[model samples]
Target: HRFGITFHRNKRSKAAINTELETIPGIGEKTVIELLRHFRSVSKVKKASETALSEVIGPAKAKIIIKHYQQTTNEN
Candidate 1:
């Protein structure tokens, strides 16, 4: 006799995953999606210059994002 087993995986929104962007105070789902789309990854987003980030997310949010990363780096 032979037996087969199957496993099911749960589908989750890309923004709902364990994302550092979500941890930032002013960032939300829409912004996370936009950042991921433009920069392709969180690491790229973290490293992007204020001018580059502003191009994608505007000046206000770019500043918030940069500051968040800077503080996180210093804490580490």
Candidate 2:
């Protein structure tokens, strides 16, 4: 007889999860704080549409946030 082992992964929301969102390329504490201030949560930040993010973060930083979210989602 043969046996196999299996593993389980946790599927938690980004906002509830305490990931180091500040570590994303081009993001820092200030930007992170600003994002949190405007969005109030990581899930909201991650889910924000480009235009909405741009309105809150400005064009350059908004692009970075968008890229970070895309990259993080891909990693998950």
Candidate 3:
């Protein structure tokens, strides 16, 4: 059914997002869950301000995540 296909696609996308989050050093499963629960997607996470991210994962980790994404963005 079309609904089944849509569900599978959503699941796949969520997994891909999780995989990308996992690649960030010092971020583990718990932090990934927290990020996803709060931001819902990697795109949202990337756009989130440091204070916003700190609300979910604390200031120290938020800076690290922001720095990591900024570095990756600069490299590209």
Q: Judging by lDDT against the true structure, name the best candidate.
A: 3
Best by TM-score: 1
Residue-wise lDDT of candidate 2 within 1-76, one digit each (tens)? 1222222222223334444667787877667777788988888888889899888778888888788778877999
Candidate 2 ranges with C-alpha deviation above 4 Å = 1-19
| Local lDDT at 7 for model 2 | 20
Better of 1 and 3 by TM-score: 1
lDDT (tens digit, per residue) of candidate 3 on 1-76: 9999999999867656545778889988789888988898888999999999999999999998999999999999
lDDT digits (tens) for residues 6-42 of candidate 1: 2222234434686889889998888988999999999
TM-scores, all candidates, are 0.79, 0.65, 0.75
- Please estimate how well model 2 matches the true structure, expressed as its whole-model Cα lDDT: 0.73
- Order the candidates by lDDT, highest first — what do you get? 3, 1, 2
Task: List per-prediction Cα lDDT, in the order shown.
Answer: 0.85, 0.73, 0.89
Off by over 4 Å in 1: 1-12
Worst 10 residues of 2 by lDDT: 1-10
